[model samples]
Every structure is written in structure tokens, then in C-alpha cells.
Target chain A: MSESNLMMHHYLAKYLRQERMPHIWCEGCGNGILLNCFLQAINELNVDLNKIVVVSGIGCIGRVSGYINVDSFHTTHGRAIAFATGVKLANPELEVVVISGDGDLFAIGGNHFIHAARRNVDIKVICANNFNYGMTGGQYGPTTPLDAWTTTTPYGNIEHPFNLAHLAAAAGAVYVARWTSLHVRRLKASIIKALQKEGFSFIEMISPCPEIFDRYNKMGTAVDVMKWFRLVSQVRHGCDPAKAEITENEILVGEFVDIEKPSYGRLLREMTSRVQDKLKREES
Target chain B: MVDESRAVLTGTHFMSGDLACAEGALAAGCQFFGGYPITPATEISERMSRRLVEVGGVFVQMEDEIGSIAAVIGASYAGKKAMTATSGPGFSLMQENIGLAVMTETPLVIVNIMRGGPSTGQPTMPGQQDVMQARWGSHGDYEIIALAPSSVQEMFNLTIECFNLAETYRVPVILLADEIIGHMWERVKIPPAEEINVVSRKKPKTPTAEYQPFKPDKDLVPPMACFGEGYRFHATGLTHDEKGAPETVSAEVQTELVKRLADKIRKNAEKIVKAQRVMLEDADVAVIAYGIPSRAALSAVREARKKGIKAGLLRLVTIWPFPQELVSDVAKQVKAIVVPEMNYGQLVREVERAAKTTPVILLSKLGEEPHRPSEIIEAMRRAVK
Candidate 1:
């Protein structure tokens, strides 16, 4: 409608469903920033948008799939990876990306995540780790830090948080990386790398849930959390993921693992052909 | 395109119901199977795991029934005819995803080989106790298509029918089998693939730019466009509009979406529901049965005829949408209706409701044993008196 508005629209990614915005993310939430970084990575990769399928589970970040103008599936809670595995196996040509929150990807869907990684299925998993489950009134989840305050843990969370990058690497992900919302450029680059990787790739984003997570823990405003991320975050490329755990004192973030192996689809195809050959030989 | 020579194991073969079901699925053009091994249903997956590879199909043993059904639904959305098999306990775990499938209107098949159960009641034993659970297992007001197979032959035949119904209506179809039929070995005729009818989901004929995922056609069924086909539409379990976008706050959208999801099956009940009527012409007494119990009923009817008593059998093939009109019509001709089920009065409740004026006798047999022919004949005699 206006000259400036029209100019801004020109800069937006073509993959984004503009009509679906403004999204339902809370004001000052880092999910928007993470989404922008993801879009930027896709734009930089110059991927065919028609061949991309964005899948998400039930959570705040799961809404990301709906906002992206791709063949998307907003699936049941914690089943995005399982669903995405089917999508990938059904058609190896499509690029299946699962974007969801920490609770959905790690807690309820933990088994699927581990199994998919172990099988080395070709999928890009982007988990937004905001420490608490923001959509369900800020409940404590698997990623909630020790002593972190949440609605369910009003006193303090006694559970230890999962170092997601370490878990991904341990579970056989070919490429694993982690970054906070403050590290937009690094996050974008890592995302592009994961998207290009052959086997299972995972990227964990330590995002800010300012309205709930931050408000409960007295972690100041969203800007304060961003500043804290800048101060405490350390990026160590090619470091051992186990040594890169996030704590109250420091946040370790980097590209921890990047390797090559035969993907599940490739192996499955080979096995099928081998079996077919044996069957033909036996028949002869 | 299904290759009959490759997929169909033609001619007669003595096979278990579970194995026959797997063959039936293969003949029906099912390309994907995601399943977990549970008692009585394990043979189906084992057969599938071996046979699917030869046909260029995928068989994945998922972590549990929840993931199995989720993967099946996902594969279905990705343009594959997918299915899964489980027994009562695993079926209980799959109820959540069944609801998800209902909401998304994803076409897939689930074979529940029933056992005695409220909770793992009898894994090795046979029981048709899941009749009511099959109808009302998942939470919500949505309708489902469930078929009951009586013999090993019917198990083969009805598995194909279930897949056809699933793809025809774009709803999850259940082959509500039991351990008796699932484990029983009998002769099954593997029909030529050309002789068997298979249905695939209607794909969007319009351009991708104009395709709406949830917009129903004249039959109230929407054309599906798979992922990687460039349709670029969204699919969610939430209350969604015709464009496949979530519209949770709108009452009109929720009502229209849910009503269409249910009405599609209800309106097509005549085309979906099927039953068999044997010797109902001049009979004053009838025995209604399904699954394993129907075999006994058939025998009992013949014995009653030999004894100079007018008796018939109404075998339920399609259990859901409850064949009310058929039951009512049969009720009007018969003075009494005898229902012999493996459960304590599950389907008999529907029988009683439909046969308002007629005396409906329940001959429920629990535990592991099915109703003997003599036991059903005894019930029929009492109903007549």
C-alpha cells in the first residue's frame, strides 16, 4: 500500500506464505528470529521450494511449518520426526525438514529422534530450545535447566537439561550444530550446511521465550536475554559435543559433527536390489 | 499400476488368516507397511516384511503402534497405500493417532486382530471383545469404516475391501479381525489381481496453484495431493479450513470440517456397509453373528433346518455404520433374534436397539473359547420359545 512497505515485501523470501503472517509467536519471542534465519538459509541454498516439505509437531515453534509456503505437515505432538521419516522414505527426492520445539523433539518424541538418527535417514531437524514448554503455560520439559523456574516447577526445576547437540551426535547424526537466536549468521550458515548434508542432520537453536520462560525466571526482557547470550555464548567449531553442555554460567555452541555415511534410503534400495538379484538367481 | 504376476500368489493355498491378510494387502496395491509385532498380528507383519521387499514396497517395524500408525498416515499422505496391523493392546496405544487420521482424513488401513482385552486380556486366546471399542475407541464424533472377517477366506477378501474403502472415502479403514480367524489355517483363494478391485485416492486434477486440500467434491470427499508433488499445501490435525489452514477459533470452520469428516462416511454407508443373509426367507428365528462366531452360527442354522425348525443367519461383514436398516428388516420377519458374540453383549446392544419389538437373546461367550454350534442352536431354540 505504501512505497516503503512494497520495498520491504521485495526483500522477503519467496518461500514464505506472506498471507499467514504475522505469526502467532509472542511479542519479543526469538522464534521469529529463528524462522528468519531458516528462511535465509533456504534462500541462500537456492533450493527448489517445490521439493521441500516442512514438518512440525505440536508446540509454539511447530507453527513454523504453516507459515512456510511448502508442502507442510503440522503433525501430532512429538511425532514430527516419525512423520518426516515416512515422508523421506516414501520419496527420497524430497527434502524433509522437521522444525519443532525442544519438548516435542526431545521429550515425547525422543525415541523417534534417536531411531531416525541411528538409521541415518536423510532429514534436517531444527529444534528451538527455549528451556520450557511455552505453549502449555510454561511447563518444565526435558530441556529445562537445573534450578530453572517454570510454572510446573514454581520453586525450581530439579531435572538436568539435555545437551541436544551431544545427543544428536551420539545418536549418529551426520551433522550436528547448536546456536542461540543471537547467532543469526552462524545459525543460518549451519542450517545451510545441515540442509546440504546427506544423512541425518540436526540444529538446535537456544531461543528466548521472553513472555513465559524469561518472565518466570526473572531473566529480564527479551533484549536482556539476547545480551546474556552474547556475553556467555562461546563458539568452538569441531569441538567434542559432550564437552559443550549448556549451563547457567556458559552456553557452548558450535558445529560439533559433520561426516558422511550411507543414508537409510540408499541402503534400503541396495538391500532391495540385492534381494531381488538373489531371488532371480534362485528362480533361474 | 499393480503387477499381478509379481504381487499376487495365484491359485489356492492353505494359509493362516494373518498371512492371507498380508497377501490381500499386497494384491490391493499397498506399497507401504509400518507395523509393530503383537501376538496374533505378528505373522501379518512378518509376511509383509518378507513379501513387500519383492514388490518394491517398504516395511518398517516401528517402535510401537503409535509410531506405526503415524508413519502409515505419513506414508499415505506421501502418495503410498500404507497399512499397519496390531492386536488389542497396541490398538489401544494407536487410538490417539487414529483420531489424528480421522481429523486429517488420511487414507490408510489398520488391522486389529482382536484378543480378550480391557488391558492385554488374552494375547494367545481368541475373543471378539473389541467390537464396541472398534466403533468408539478413538475420542470424537467422527465415523469410521470397520469390516469383520469370518473365515481365512474372508480375511483375505475383506483386507482388500478395507483398503478399497480407505482409499475411496479417504478415511482410516479397520479390518477388525480376531485371534480365531487371524490364527486359523484354512484354504484361501488368491484371486488374480485383475479380478480384484483396488481403489486409490482421487488426486487433484486442477493446477497446484489453485488446488485446495480440504475442499470436498460432490461426494464430500476431497482430492489428495501428496508431498513432493509441488501442491505445497498444509495438512494438520487441528480444525482446519478448506485451504488446509488451521482455523481453530472459528465455530463455522470446526463444524463444517468435522461434520464433513463424519458425514462423508455416514452418507456413503449404503456403499460401505455390507452383510450376508443366509436362509432368512421363511425363518421365524434368526441368529446374528460376525467374525469367528458367524461360522458357528452358520453351522447352527443348518442343524436347525435339519431338525425342521425355521432358522437363519445374518453375518455382519461390515461392523460399523451398524447395518441398522438390514437388522431392522430382518427383525420384522423373525419373531426372535439370537446374537452370539465372543464378548458379553457388545454388538447385541445394537441388535436390541434395532430389533425393537422382537425378543433379542444374547449368547455371549467370553474367555478363550468361541460359541459352539450346539451352544448357538440352544440359544436359537430359547429365542424361539
Candidate 2:
């Protein structure tokens, strides 16, 4: 939106793309931009890209692993979080990042995400919420806005879109934030903070899928779709659940939550030593 | 669960496939086992958890089969010979990550003591439905070295072989066992330490700086560096170049990656493939069998000898890499081949393919119950006549 933000976006895109895959995501898809923001965050944070593992589930956004030049994994649908958690717990030294689409993370693997966050695993999850199934022919998903027309829900969406940031915060995610693709700089900062935080951190990027979601919803252009994102979203920080409303053309996106706690890796080590101590006492 | 007696001892006793698998992992120098309990294979997780700790190793019960394999792969990447065991259902859950190991060329052992399935078909019962799935379970074209052991000893030896093959090749090896072997207890001897040849994955013999995780070496299997190791190499499930970074998902990368993956096993198939032949020096008919059915076939052949039918036996010690050429050559000399299996005509196709001029017959039973020696005898007599 600003000249500085455009330069920031341009700078972020430099080191993110693989030569073979200049662009695998559909045109007007925010996945590439989201990936750019992630790269900028990790780059700005000065992480060892060698030790940084960008894990993704199977989807358009999941292909982020394929483009990122890291020790990444393009895992099976909904299992990236589980795999990333294993990778994190296995070494505890590697910086693991799970970049998954809303459908990839929420619908099938929502349980794993919650449990992992609850345990405070030292990993950052950057979830791209396009509010519809952008891949697989624009089907209605868990994050599909209420009353949105989709291939599966032709008449209207009957299900409520999950307020993912709120849920992550509630589930013991030490740091949590939500931002639209429009605010790439803020999202980048949020990701950097989440990556730096030594516990379970979650960031939801309300991305636009102009080709699929926009066409299906009869929204004409990317600009209009972004406008809808701005209008529908309540900029309510400490955004109370009781005040949450379901209005057509309304969506919520901003830095929703942030905090800190002992990471799962830390607690696990503690548990291991405690057991070892107990065994020693009994033996003595 | 703590076998305070330690792993360095000679033992002969009845045990299921799971316990035998655990001991095999231990003897193979596996110090880490991460898995979850799934039927026909729960004993493996339980035993591995207990034994790994006693051996000053690590056993982590991950949340699911996916996590189980993930943890083991991570541990393997951490410079440990690691493993995880599960059954058909869990194996189904593991297919995706199995592909991850395939693409990453991660060295680990997975014991698939198969039960019936498309999904949760027969958790406790025995089945060989995973025969086709084991080879092509992961969505890719690569050579998977799966070994099927007929007896408890096969389970023990095959488990060790699985690890050795995995480490030597830097690829995941499957101990394709069954519920019967997994649950049955039989005498087994832990191999003497002096005789046991443990192969850790080939570390970079060159300067660590020149190491590429997915690059083919002289043997086609590239030396892999552990995670904590200073060598900086990236691993991805995506179609990767020699350096283990994601390359284009095109025909070229696919061709190169798939060829390398398949070639690694194909090049070493001779060294990896194992099987057994009995009474084939002068025989008219042969009993082609593996797994529990082979046990029956062994008995049937002994009875056929008493009857003077010239019925020999060809037992497939390695279920995968199929022992086809050997079977085919052996089959040409015989009049007919009797294939008695637990599943309905699963291995019969292989026998028929192997036996060109000879009659290739099938005696199959699809039941919760296993095959009887008499059933195989009846088939053998029919073939001989």
C-alpha cells in the first residue's frame, strides 16, 4: 500500500524463490508473497538457513517447501505439523517452521495443531487462511467464511470459519498473530517475532485467492477482495470472543496474541532428567 | 520391561514378531526407537521402549505412526541407527513419510507386521493383503527392499538385515512380516557380537565440504551427514538435485531422482536378496512358498518325500525383489509348482510367472485361520499328478 512496503516486498522476494520454480502457486495467489514474508522474517532474524526447516503439508501453500531452499519437507496432507513436531523434538536445535494452508492445518489436522500448541513445542506455524479451498477447485473449507458460495456449498456456507488466531492463543501458543497479505511488513514482523520466540508460536495470514475464491464468490477483482478483507476484519486486539460477529463481507486480521512459556523441548528434557533422578534415588 | 540381563547373551525362546523385531533392532546397533502401538505390532513398540532404555538408548512413543516414522527419521539424521515398527493400518498412515525418507534417503528400519487391511480390515488376524502395497505404498517410483521372514528366526535375522541394508544404502528398509510370525513365539539366538557386522551409514569419506546429501557416489548411495554434523546439506521430499535442495518438478528431475532411487536398490539387489531352496537337485514338482504358508509347505514336502513324489521346496526368504530369476530357472526343470499361501492366490501369480513350461498351481486360504500342512499336501499331490 505504501512505497516503503513495496520496496520491503521486493527485498523479501529476492532470496525466497528457487531457480527451477519461479512461481508454482496460481496467479494472484498470495502464497508466494506469504513465502516471501516468511523468508524476510527468517532472513531479518538472522537464522541459520541451514538449520531452518520449512515443513509444509500437501496443498498450494504446502508447496512452499518445494520453493524454499532449506532442509524442508513437503509432507502428506495435514501431517506437516506432526512431522515438524517430531523434527523439533528430535534435535531441539533445528529451527522448525510449519507453513500450511488453513484447510491443510485445520480440517484434517486440527487436532495435531491444538495438541502441539498445548505442549508449547518450540516451532513457529505460519498458516495461510485464504477463507476457501484455493487448491482442489475451490471447495468449502473449515475457514471458508460463513455464507460464502463455494463448489461444495453452492447455496451458501452454513459452517462458521474458525477464528484461528484466537484458538492458537487459547491452546497455549506462546505467541500468536493474524494479518492479511495486504500488510506484508506487519506480517513479516509478526513472523520474525514468532520465529524468535522459544515456544509454540502461530501466525495466521488471511491471504487472497483471486482466481478461485474471488471468482466463486462473484468478487470481480483482487482490489475488491482486499477491500472486503479490510471491512469485515475487526481491528480488535484482546479481541474478545463475545464481541465476535458474523457479517457478510467482514473478516478479522491483525496481531491477535503474543506471550511466552517453556517450550515442549525444554519441558521434555526436564521430564527426562526428573525420571533419571528418580531412578537414581531408587537405585541408591 | 527392562531386560537387565542386557542384550549380549545367547537365548532360545518363543517370541512374537514384535519382540524378535526389537531384539533384531538392538543387535543391529539401533539405539533409538520411536513408535506408537498399533495391532499386530504393539509388542514391538512395547519391547523396543523397554529394551532401548536398558541398553542406554532412547525410546520415544510418538503420537501416531506418522510421528513414529518422523521421529525415527529425525533420530537417524542425528547419527543414530533408529527404527519404528507398525502394521498395515499404521503402515498406511506411514506411506507419506515413507516417501519423505525415500526422497531424503534417510536410513531407518520399519517393521510392517501386516494384518488385513484397506482400512482396519483385520487388526488381530493374519493377512498378506499388503503384498502389492508394500512395494508401491508410497506415491513414487523407487525400489523398496522388503523382506518377509517365515519363521521367528527370520524375523530376528531379517530385522538385523533390514537395518544393515538401510544403513548401507541410506534408504528405509521394510521387514515385511505377518501377524502370525509377530505373535508366534519360537527359539531364537542373539547373534554373537563378533559375528554381527553393523553398518553405520557411510559418512562423507571426502571433505565434509564436498558432501551432497542426495548425490550418487561410486556405489550410488551417497554418504549422509548427520544434522548436528557441521556439514551443511539440505534434504527435501520434493524432487531434489544432487545437493539435496529442491529442483524443478519436471520429467528431468523426476527421471534423475527416480532412476537414482531405483538404481540404488537394483544395483545392490544381489547383495540384498535372500531365499532358500530345498531338495531341488532332482525334483519333478516344487512347493513355492513364503511366510506361514512356507512352514506348511516345508511339512508337505517332507510328506511328499515319504510318498516318493519328488516334491521339492523353494521358499522365498525375501518377499520383495521376489527371488524371481532363481524361481524361474528352478521352475523350468520341475513339472509343476505348488503355491500355497494364506491370502487367496497372492503369490501364485509370481509362481505362474516363474514357471513357463511347468504347471503353476495355487492352493490358497483366505481366513482368520492359517494354512494347514494337509492343505499344502493336497495341492502338492494334485500338482505332482
> Could you say which candidate leads in lDDT?
1
Show model 2 residue runs off by greater than 4 Å.
A1-21, A25-29, A169-172, A215-235, A240-263, A274-284, B1-14, B31-34, B53-67, B70-80, B117-119, B192-194, B205-212, B226-240, B243-249
Ten residues in sequence with the least summed lDDT for candidate 1 chain B:
B1-10
- Top model number, DockQ: 1
Reference-based lDDT, each prediction = 0.90, 0.78
TM-score of chain B of each: 0.98, 0.95
Error of 2 at B38 (Å): 2.3
The candidates' DockQ values read 0.68, 0.27
lDDT of 1 by residue, B42-112 (tens): 99999999898888888888878888998898889888899999999999888988998999999999999
Docking class of 2: acceptable
Q: What is the lDDT of residue A184 in candidate 2?
A: 84
The RMSD of every model to the true structure, in order and in angstroms, is 1.5, 4.2
